[model samples]
Every structure is written in structure tokens, then in C-alpha cells.
Target: MQFFPIFLRSEGARIVVSGGGETALAKLRLLLKTRARIAVHAAEADPKILDWQAEGRLSWVARPVEAADLDGARLVYAATDDAAEDARVAGLARAAGVLFNIVDNREDSAFITPAMVDRDPVVVAIGTEGAAPVLARKIKAGLEAWLPAGLGARVRAANAFRPEAEALPQGRARRGFWAAVFDGALDGRAPEPLDRLLEAHKAARPAVGEVLFVGAGPGDPDDLTMRARRALDRADVVIHDRLVPAPILELARREAEIVEAGKTGFGPSTPQEEINRLIVGRAAEGLVVVRLKAGDPSVFGRLDEEIEACEAAGIAWSVVPGLTAASAAAASLGQSLTRRGRNSDLRVLTGHDVNGLADHDWATLARPGAVAAIYMGKRAARFLQGRLMMHGAEAATPVSVVENAGRPEERILAATLGTLATEIASTELTGPAVILLGLAPRAAARSLPLLQEAAR
Candidate 1:
């Protein structure tokens, strides 16, 4: 980010503004909201400035601003219309080692004022480094409308109990108490609940940690469920797989410890035992741990093993289902995994099993109307081709390979079973891919023109 958002302590601080017109008034209006001692220096002042001075709202210096004007100022704003004057004030403020902003001049300014949401102790600031003031204001307006009017009051009431909460010990006990309050365990909708929560929190014990197995969906962050998002938001640690997209992980709390437990098909992978141990270990430390898996964790994600591990360790755990690869692949192709007449049952098959090259009922799968979505099938393409062909399956049976389904870079390669292996071999595949058997693409497969091999 060009400008880092931070809240400065304005109470008892000194701030100086140099201008008499609307620009200065705008800056003063925001500054007045803070408890800072404000000083305005202008040769000619606006009537509002005079009114504010008479009301003891601010101090007005009836002269041009000089270097001395910013001697002890924590921040300075130069809103003068004259460019030279603004520059001079900026230079003086910088030389005095004060953070300053020159109105409409971001290049020379040390700070830019952000569109703010004033909810007292629950303030929110939105800024675009002075590049998009209108956008920032729009965002601020949206926030103002969405936030309840009594939010500030509720937050202040909670703040009053912070001292006692802090005394409870520095750990999850204190944090969980506040979390419970915000979660409406204390009825944050009203003020009386705050008093009750404070009294009850004093004797409350620390909450036990939990493990949540959350499905990240097929590379699309928007596909994530609300429950999964909340789990990520509250996660103290996240154990993620290789295929989970970065956007989905971005939903996790910034303070959350992200541990890569990525397992690649036919490649180097974290041992399942080690991953299980890691989850249990983190949860044992009273941390909310999330085992983030790509797509639906229940579908060939080795979820049962992890869940069993948690159960054996006496760790509480839950699951948040997500859109599986089959669904996403079908969506990308504008096709369906199961059709009313074509197929009554849908099967989710893995390309390989414990013995490698998963063995299934080839006769049934190769039946004329059969359909299946195959996961991790890219490497076992030849094996699948041979098996289906041997079982009296038609060489013309349609097949499609969806690479990185639901991602921006997703691609669909379609061909008959006769050329499925050849098409996949000639294509450059990246990211996790899933194969659809007995399902045709919405349009004809665009074949990758292959160069004919010269006779040996």
C-alpha cells in the first residue's frame, strides 16, 4: 500500500492548519472531532473561523504561518490556494520534523487524510493515497449507512469493562471473553448486557480450542461459505493444502499463523501423519486451528484420516463443506455430471488408490450411458484409456479435462476417449486438473494441432 493506515493519538496533541477558505475549513472540521489543540494561521480568516475562536473551539493566529508556527505541532495541514504558499508551509513543517499534508498535493505531503467513519473508539479509515477521493468517500458513506447508530455507545460500554478483562490474565481467556461479548453472548445490542458480561467474565474460564476442516472451493474465493469465512477469521492457525487458492487464504486473519501442508499429486508432499500431528498440536495449545483443504474436504481430500486423528487426540473438530471439483468443472464446461436420461447415478473416482492406479468396475463405468468425474487423473491418463478401451468402451466416448477449474486461467480440453491421452499430452497443463468422462463440452473440443511424427 502507498499509504499505511494508522490511527494517531490526537488527545492532548497540537495540530496546525494554514488557510482561511473552504479547504482549510474542511480540514478543521475533521480536526475538531479530535481532542487535539488546533491552531489556525491565516492573514484573512473565514467567519466560521472567527465563530469557532469565539466559541473556544480553536486558537486563531492573525498572521501568515512561519516555521515557528509548527515548532511543537504534531501535524500540519497547508490548505492555502496559492501553490507557493502551500509548498513553503510544507517545507517549513518538514524542516521542523512534523508530519504535514499539502492539500491536493500528494507528492509533497507526508500524510493524506482518509475518508473516515467516526464511531468514536471504533473508528474506520478508508484511503487511496489521495488517488481516489471520491471512491474513498463512497466507501465511507456505505460504512456510515451500514453501521448502527448505537455502535459507538455499545463499544464505549464494552471499553469500560476492559480494565477488569485485562486483569483476568494475558491470553485467550481475555480475548474469548471479548469475542463472546461481540458474538452477542452478552447481548451487545443493549447497554445492560455489558454490565452483566463484565461481572460474569471475571469467573469465566478460557474456552477450549477447536479444529475446523474448511473447504476452500475450486480456486474461487467467492465460492467459500459464510461459516468457512468466519472460521478463517477466527483461526489462530491455518494448515492449508497445495491447491487452495491464495485469494481464499487471504480471508484468514492477518495474525493467523499459516502453515503450508501442501500435498501435490505424484510429487513431494507433507506426510499425512505430520500434518495430522501439526493440527492436533496447535489445537492443544488452545488455538483455533483450521485445516484448509481445496474443494470439498469430504471428496478425496483424505479428510476422514485427519478427522480420525483429531478424534483420537480428543480434539474437538467440525467441517465446512465446499463446492467440489466435479461441480466446478461441470460449471466451467456448461455441462452436468448427471443427466435425467443419460445417467441416473454419478460417481467421483480417484485416478489412483493405495496400490496406485485405482481399480474400479470398468465394465460398469464403460457402459454406454455411464458418467464419472475423475480427480488426479492427469498422470493416469494412459491407464484410464487402456482400461476403458479394454472394457468394450467406445473409442468415441466424449471426455473433457478441465485444468484449474473456477480460476481465471482455467482451460477446457475436450476429445473422445480415443484421443483423450494424446490431447492431454500435447497440452501444457498447469494447476490441479479434473477429468470428465462421458460428458461432452458445450462446444466441440478445439484440438491442439499436433505435428505429425516422421516415420522412423
Candidate 2:
């Protein structure tokens, strides 16, 4: 970010503006909302400036700005509407060690004003680093419509009640109490008396932590569900898997503690029991824990075990579904997991399990037009190919292996069942990949001129 957004304490501070025309008037309109003491320096003043000066809203000097005038100023705005004059004033402000802004000149300005939604204590500032002022204003307009006009009053009431609310224990209890109060207030209903609310909060049982199994969605942040995003935002501890991408992990709060409990297939991995214990232990400490997994947790993720652990420990748990890798891979291939006239049922299978290469009903899976999305199938390609072929599956059946589905470095390797293992080996697939049995990229099929070529 070129300009970090901060709320400067403007109360009782000095702000200098070196213009008096429309540009200066535009800035003064917003400045008047602040508590800062505004001073305008211009040889000729606008009628509005004269009115404001007469009303004592601001001090206006009937002469050009000078270096001495910038002393003790917290901020200066060179809105002279003339490039040379604005630059000259900017130089003086810089020499005086005051932050200066050149109106409409972002490149030369030390600070740029943000579009704001004013709700008194509930002000929201929207900025684009001066890249898109129109977009910023549009966002401000939307927020202005969404936020309640009475929110400021509610905030004031909460501020007044804060001293009594602090009597509750800190951490989750205090936060929960405040959350309940604002949640009710935002519903537009008349607020309950603060004393009654405080007594009710005190009488309420202590808050207990819970676990949310959130799907991170195939290595893409955009694919994350709003429910999953909210879970991450409120998470106190995030236990994520290896396949969960960094971009998705970045959604967690900065104060959140991140723990990597990745389990790789047939490779070095953290024990499942240990992961379950970690989830239960963290939740037991009254912390909101998020067990973040890639893709749909119920699909291939060992979700049942973690839930069982939580149940045994009497810890509450919930699930937030995500877009699975199979769906993303199919989208990337321009194909569907199931088609009306082709496959009636879609099977989601794992490539390996505790015993070894996971065995499925090869008889049904070998049938013509059978469709399946096989996760963790990269290393088990040869085993899968041999089993399917042994069960009378067609050697020429189309198979596509999608590596890093929905990610920037995604790769789709198209081949027939006959060459599935060979193609996988040749590609040296190193990333998490899914195998789509009986499917090919639609683009690749369309490129073939002959019907027979396209069929293959």
C-alpha cells in the first residue's frame, strides 16, 4: 500500500490550506467536519471562505501563505489550483516538517484524503491510494446506504456502558458480551436497558470455545465461501493442512496462531491422532479453533476422526463446506463430473488409505461411461491403471490428471487409461493432483478434425 490508512487525532490540531477558490472550498467542506483548527491563506478569498471566516468557523488570512504560517501545523494542503503555486507551498510545508497534500496531484502529495462514511465514532474511510477516486466514492455511497444512521448513537451508548461491562471477566467473556450487545443493537430494535443487559450478561454462563472445519477451496482464495471466510476471520487458532494455499491462509487474523498439521499420502506427515488432539486441546482452552482443509472437508479429508475427537472432549464443532478440487478440475477441463446421457452417478474416491492403494468396486468403476474423481491419485496411477484394466476396463478410456487444481500453476495432463501411468510418470507430477477417470479436456477434443480422433 502506497499510503497506510490511519486515523489521525485531529482534535485541537492546526490544519493549513493555501487556496481560496473552488478547490479550496471542496477541501474545506470536509475539513469542517473535523475538530481541527483550519486556517486558509489566500490573497483573494471566495465568498464561502469570507462567510466561514466571519462566522469564526476558520481563520482566513488576506495574504499569500508564508513559511512562518506553517509552523506548529499538523497538516497542510496546497489546493492553490495552480501547479507552480501548489508546488511552491508544498516545498515550504516540507521544509517545516509538516505533512503536505497537493490537491488533485497524488504523485507530488505526501498524503491523500480518503472518501469517508461519517457515523461519528463509527466512521469508515475508503481509499484507493489515489488510483480510483470514483470507485472509492462509489464504495462510500454504498456504505452510506448500508450503515444505519443511528449507529453513532448506539456506539455512544456502548462507550458509556463500557465501564460497567468491564466488570465481566476479560477474553472471550468480555468479547461475547459486547458482541451480543451490538448484535441486538444493529437489529434496529429498541435496545434493552444497559443495566438489565449487564445483569443478564453476568448471569449468562461462561463462553466455551468451538472448532469449525472450514474448507479452504482448492488453493484459491476466491473459491472460499463467505461462511468459511467468516470462520477464518474469527479464528483464534488456525490448524491448516499442507495443500491449503498461502493466499487462503492469509485470510486468518494477524493475531491468530497458525499450526501446520499437514498429512501427506505415503510421505512424512503428522499423525492423525496428534492432529485430533491438537484440535481438542486448543478448543478446550476457550479459543476459537479453525481446522482449515483444502477442498470439501467431507470428501477426502479425515473429517470424521476430528469430529469424533471433539465429541469425545465435549467440544462444539461445525463444518463450512468449500468448492472441492474435483469441481475445480472439471471446470478447468470444461467438463462435468456427470452428464445426462453419459454417467448417472458420480463417485468420489481416494487413491490410497491405511492399507495401501485404496480399492474400489473395480467392476462398476470399469463399466463403460463410469465417471469418478480420484484424489491423492498421482503416486497410485500405475496401481489404479492395473486394477481397472484387470477388471475389464477399456485401455483406451480417456483419463485426465489435473495438478494443482484452481491454482495459478495448474496443469492438465490428458491421456488414455492405457498410458495413464506413463503420462503421469513423464510429467513427474509433484503437486497435489486429482485424476478424472473417463474424461478429457473439451478444448483438446474439439481440436481433433476426425470424429474417431476426437473420440479417443
Candidate 3:
């Protein structure tokens, strides 16, 4: 902030150089494009500078700067070996209402050029404001990767569309149209002039309040439906929960602001009401907002309040469903919740005694040939099994304990209900386990290979 940032064009302007070596020659060659009236004061000249003098590209005098160097000079550069003469010329320029730069001496000069990134006519000028040119160059290099080579052409293309945007009557419709265009959301060349299309776009602007409920899905990112991916990509801002992994978050647009609502079982979570505010606020700003939650939003996810808020705001929104962990767990273990006549009923429950198991109808668990998917039932499996047995349930029932379902690291334990405790005790696996209980048909059952000897 301490350094002034300004662009200078020396065309038909007066400027002075006080050096004749490679440094001065290089500076002079760059200035020739500006068509600046440049005069050099040096005792000796480099070969390039001498050739330019012979060709009349620039003019120079001998014995460095004397009294005559300040004549009509608007700017002066003290790029000389003699520090004493550089200071004298700098002082003269200062008294003559001129800007002087004693090269490399920022304290003694008015201007200090920076190592710039010139993708002109789309130049990105990075300056430390003369604080640190080296640091400025480093910053420029980092930006070189993301910036396209044809950025100058892209800038020209955008400028060409200014006429189309201005021709439309001034209003929110017109402003919003351009806002969506130059918002940097779209890259590369502008499309063909589609005036007819613009009218349709302006007329069909999206609702002010609309929520896009996105499903984070079970652990794996690939399991996310195509609809879910599109929903995330269109989101102006994302209000994501904890279970949504970092990889899934990367799929969102770079400008799509991300806000973490620590809704995970254990984490630094954002409060629910605040999350609701963020989603609604972004949507209200005519933004496509996505609320990302693990599993389907309507399930355990606090979709109730979010839905109510969206409804109250009068926003148009939709839901994108995902593969719930329960289904994933069953699929990973090659088990089914229902098997034709084998399982007449299929039940899903949380064994964590959400409030109390006494309130739960444990007697329904005694039904014959019924399948049950128990979520987070690893620790309470034995207690639930005891309840089932007491409720007239058969002691021998096929059960598969699936953990880390449908992931690269999936494991399953197949055992009878009576040995549930003993079987789970042998496996040290933990974290979000599910239990699939029922009698499996032969095709669904997993069996070890048996050696069959053919007598030869």
C-alpha cells in the first residue's frame, strides 16, 4: 500500500536514461515501443546502444548527466555506474517536477519497476509496491499455472459482449445477465451472439429461494448419483456436513463457497440454525445453493427444518437421493433384507436405544423368516439378540455383521444368532457397523472352496 501503482505510456512523452551498458540498452529497447523521446548521458555505450544511435532509434551524449539533461524531461532513470552522478541527476529531476528512478535504490527514486507477468493485452501486474520485487515474481509464477495462454483473447472476447449487455434496458434483468456472464464462472471464448437466447434467459430466471438437497452418499464418492453431481456443481455455495469427505467437496466449482456444518457424530460442528441461514441466504441472493448431507437428506439428516425454511422462503428446490449406508452394508456382504418366502418381512432399526428399547416393539422381532437390518448394532447386538430370543424368536438365525460397507476395506462375519456375541468378540473391527439377519438362500451364501478329488 505504501507504493503507488500506476500505468505509464511514454508515447510523445519525454524521458531520460543515464547509462550506456547492457542494462541501459535493454531499457532503451523496451522504451522504443512506447515511442518515448529518450536521451542517454553516458561516456561509453554498449554495442547495441551504439547500433541504435547509428540507426537513429535514440540519442545519447557524453560525460554522463550535466545541466542540459533536464530539458523538458518528464521522467528520468539513473541507471549508471557512478552513484554520485546518479544522485545528482535524481536531485535535478526532483527539482524539475519530474519522476526519477535511481535503479535499485528505491529510497533515492520515485519508481521501482516490478518483475511482471505480461499476458498483454491481458497483463496481470503483480507488484510488492516496491517492497519486494523477488516476492512479486514468486507470486506471478504461482498464478501462471491456472491462467490460460489465450487470456488476452478471452479479455477481448468479453469486451466485445459489452455492447450486447448495454443494449438491453437497464434493470435487474440486464444487470443479472451480465453478472452471470463475467462472473468468471464461464471460461474461454464467448459464444456466438445469441440475442434471442438472452431474452429467453432473462425471462426465465430461477426462483429467488430454492434449495438443492444433495446426498453425500455412503463413504464412497463414486456412489453419488449423476443427479447429485449436477446439483453440487450448480450450487453457488455449499453447506456440507462432516461425513462429506474432502474428495467429494473438490467436485464443486472453485468459486462455490464451502461452509462446513459439523453435523458429524463427533467434530467441530456448525449449529443447525446457522447452517439453515447460510443455505437460505445464498439461495435468496439468486444463487444455486446445495445442502450436502451424508446419506439421503430426508432420513436422519436434519432435512425437516431445512425443508421448512426453504418452504417459508418460497424457493424452488429438489432432492437428489444417495445410496444409504444400510443398503451399502447389505450389498457389501452379499446379503438381502428380504428373501422371497424365506423372509416374509424386512425391518430396519437403530440399536443405540435412541431413547429406550422398552418403547420399541421387540415382539415384532420374533416373526418367523423375517429379515432385519440393525444399524450401529455392534455393541448392543447381544442385548438385542437376548430380547429377540425371549420374544419367541428362534435361537438359530443366520446373521451377517458387515463393517465399513461397500468400501475398499470391507469385512463381514457370517454366523448364527446364537453365536453373535462369540463371533463379534473375535473381530476387532469397529466404526459404524450394520447387522443383516435372516436365512440366506444357497445362491446368496458365501462358502469356502471344497476339494473334490476325481479318481483317475
TM-score for each prediction? 0.83, 0.89, 0.53
Give a tens-digit lDDT track for model 2, residues 13-111: 999999999999999999999999999999999999999989999999988789999889999999989999999999999999999999999999999
Off by over 4 Å in 3: 1-192, 199-207, 264-271, 353-359, 421-430, 439-456
**lDDT per residue as tens, model 3, 28-137:** 76577566887888898887777777888788787677666787887888888678988988888888878888887888778876665656566667877677777887
- Output the TM-score of candidate 2: 0.89
Worst-scoring 10-residue span by lDDT in model 3: 447-456
lDDT against the true structure, each candidate: 0.86, 0.90, 0.72
Candidate 1: tens digits of C-alpha lDDT, residues 1-456: 877888899998999999989999999999999999999999999999999999999999988799877878999999988899999999899899999999989988999988899887778899888888999989999988877667777778777867767766666667666776776422335444755666687777676788999999998888888998989998999999989878888899898899999987778999999999999999989899999999999999899999999999999999999889899888877787888888999889999986899988999899998999999998899999999999999999999888888777777777789998987787778668898999877753233221121111
TM-score of 3: 0.53
lDDT of 3: 0.72
Candidate 2, position 444, lDDT: 55
Mark the regions of model 2 whose C-alpha exceeds 4 Å error after superposition.
253-255, 389-396, 408-411, 426-430, 444-456
Considering every candidate listed, which one attains the maximal lDDT?
2
Q: Could you arrange the candidates by lDDT from highest to lowest?
A: 2, 1, 3
